[model samples]
Target chain A: MNWKRYERASDLNGALTLLDRAEGTGRVIAGGTDLVLQLGQRQKSAELLVDVTGIDELRGLCASGAWIRIGAAVTHREAAASGLLREEAAVLAEGCGMVGSPQIRNIATLMGNVITAQPAADAAVPLTALGAELRVVSAAGERWVPLEEAYRGVGESAIDATREVATEIRFRRPGAGAKTRFFRLARRKALALPVLNGAVCLWRDGDAGRIREARIALGPVAARPFRARQAEACLTSDRITAALLEEAARLAAGEATPRTSLIRGSEEYRRAMIRLYLTRTLWEMLDIG
Target chain B: MDHGVKIRMKVNGQWREAETTPDRLLIDLLREEFGFTGTKKGCGEGECGACTVILNGRPLLACLIPAAKAEGADILTVEGLTPEQGLHPIQQAFQDEGAVQCGYCTPGMVMTAKALIDENPSPTEAEIKRAISGNICRCTGYTKIVAAIVRGAALLRGEAATTPAGVDRERVPQLPPVGPG
Candidate 1:
């Protein structure tokens, strides 16, 4: 709410320069669903808001080479409605669709969701599980940061947003036998944050065959969305039995470090949910019990 | 420092400009500056869809958007839906279906429907539910509201709508303007 001026960047270079000039006092305004809310709460302040909606480069969903690219400016609505994502990475599409409301999804950007780095941020759950990478750009240069290592804690990111902008979000386009699932339970069907959310990506050898690779990510279970490394290690074999799922769920439950929140849920409840959701997601994706 | 920033946008269909503060939200700008009080503010945290307005062809929560960032954008509020030709089809349908209880959430609901019906003239019942999921109505349940939207979609496609058996559709009451010129 303390912004001194507003400027719409005509292009990426102009946006970087404005951010560079504002030093730490500038905030990039994308969909403004998140940025504006933070500003309204006075949780975040700025001297300048470099509206990046004008930049053509930071928009749209595209598949390049081996990765599917999502521009920073791509809204939740756009991501949810994307036919390409629905076909290739339907989990991401489903995740984005479950954001807030039609109004929120229409303006809230996926990049904003990822940058906010909320442990339970819906978009980040799938991005982390699917091994998404962010393309960070600044006046200095550009770099690629994996979604897993990008954050240090809730609302904290290794990437300095004031100095750099998230230009794109991309992940590998999974091939045959690969499936991903995202599951979350909120108080209501809409307009409520997930009490606990989980996303899993796994691949089988063939139709009704052995497991190849697996990745699991849980949110609000820690300072940031985390990879259930031990659980994933359990899933890296052809023998994916119900016992294996049980073991992996137990591991994931141990992986979470949830807290007692008045709004969310208790640490014990969160742990139980991590196990249940992990079991359900694995069975649902693999078409088992 | 001067917080006044220039914003040029198309409201309804006409181009307009306003010098507002960087912190001035679209809901405030529309209600205070332009007198578009039809847009209400509820649950300012973007949970309730009462502040919804179409910005650049998408329904957005105005309370969460700064007016200065809306520059060059084409916005449509509930007022824009009304033409010299009378109430917009959706508004008429809402009235016909008795969808207005408190009338607080009507404007935002109608704008959200406009956004959906414009893109998909024949939206499925499921799609309609998904599209309006952001809007919350405390009275009359959402059944009538959803039906009104379905009928509104039909009306937009120029189809004749017959009142369901035992259902009486009312017209907007003709009342004189109250107070202030």
Candidate 2:
């Protein structure tokens, strides 16, 4: 609890002005699920906390044409309950639904999950697969940073929270031919961190029955959310087949770099599970037995 | 800069005000400042739901929320459950089902159940389990807690209460009346 001042920002400009006034010692606090705990544990320090939850511009989930925008204050519970996300971005909804318990979900925002930048963050893994972009606002101006580029390393975010506010996360809605799936392997069903989590967004050609485009995102297997580009390349423009799926799974398993840890288990096990989970996710997406 | 900030919020249907530090947790403000001790502090972190409270119609971990965040928000704690005369239906259901053992997790469990039942009047067994998943009960093993929630739902729906197979309805112990602390 190193905080010396806390101010609630009623709008985006107010937030930026507060941050600019604090210089580099201020940090944005939304949901506070991670930041509060980190501050309590003395893992992080902040001289001022700019509360962004009060800002009206940073609220709700909405759709505009092909893009869906989720404001930074949108909690996991709200996202999970959203009819739009469930129908169009089912993988993101599923990933968010698996985060923590009901209490945690009710207040833990999706942007907070992304900003915390945990490698295996449930929400971030699916957002990565969905190719979401972050709208970051600072005193200079606003910029959209691709979700992949937003991560600096494990537990590190390229967006400086002290000087910037991640306003929203936006991604194009999955088209009619597209389907997505997310799978998480954890110690327990609730209130447990993921040992390994994965998400896949795939589009199939209607007439040709070929894979149109695919994005495979897996986590706790690399420094940040790891995209299996090689694995995705094997499926793109290829006709659907069990053999091809297996080959892609093998490539994905080879691409992962999971570390052996006390909680998540050995690297050998996670690598094997990656192959199995990726295969199952693709199979479920394609309705393959 | 470390001086206390004045914050006003509605707690348990009454408006209350408190001056708190920037880093003071909501749980501390409720228990220490306002004397709403029913909200227990279990893990102090968000891992345990012993400090669960309803904020703006959502059940959230009070320990994780800063006191300043509760400004102008509505909060409901376990102490707010009872009515004018007797125990709340949920509390009565817990008593009938013997849901209280160590009683440490009861406040959180009850608050979580209240939020769930308020949203979904007829929650299934799985829903009840999921609703109270964050609340850790070491004594009851959650079997009675789940049963109590189901029974509480039934009672809330104005249905007649049926006695559990083994428990004697006449011998059920009475809970002390709850009021503003």
- RMSD after CA superposition, every candidate: 3.8, 4.3
Candidate 1 off by > 4 Å: B1-3, B162-181
Candidate 2 chain A minimal-lDDT segment of 10 residues: A203-212
lDDT of 2 at A25: 92
lDDT by residue (A1-289, candidate 1, tens digit) is: 4677878888899989989998888878888777777876788778788888778998869999888999988988899889988888877888898888878888789998988878888888988988999999988899999998889778877777777888899999987678888888889888888898878888888977888889898887898988999999998877778889989999989977888888887888889988998898887777776
State which candidate has the highest lDDT: 2
CAPRI rating of model 1: medium
Each model's lDDT: 0.86, 0.90
Clashes of each: 0, 0
In DockQ, how does model 2 score against the reference complex?
0.68
